[model samples]
Target: LSSSMYEQIFDRTVSVKQRDREVSSFQLTYWINWHRNRHAPVRVLIREF
Candidate 1:
């Protein structure tokens, strides 16, 4: 999804950092319960205006 400048979207400001670690993370998933389905996993890319 496309978003606008901070003036329009930001209510506050903050910074975040991740710690380096060696770990095996497991993925949890479930199937759709409805009729419609995804053809494949969703994809993202750099948006050019």
Candidate 2:
């Protein structure tokens, strides 16, 4: 019973780590896209004027 509990804990930790990695990567890409989009309009305006 103790061993099974330990296994469950380990599995939970691994899943949490995996979720964290996925969230970080998603946030990174989202930030990059936002930065690009935010700057693009300004760049175009500067070019136009």
Candidate 1 differs from the real structure by a C-alpha RMSD in angstroms, to one decimal, of: 10.8
| Candidate 1 C-alpha error for residue 37, in Å | 12
- Scored by Cα lDDT, where does model 2 land? 0.48
Q: What tens digits encode model 1's per-residue C-alpha lDDT throughout 1-49?
A: 1233431222121111112233212211121111013222122111100
Candidate 2 C-alpha lDDT tens digits along 1-49: 3644544554464456456756675664564456446443334224322
Count of steric clashes across candidates, in order: 0, 0
Off by over 4 Å in 1: 1-19, 27-41, 45-49
Query: In candidate 2, what residue range of length 10 has the lowest lDDT sum?
Result: 40-49
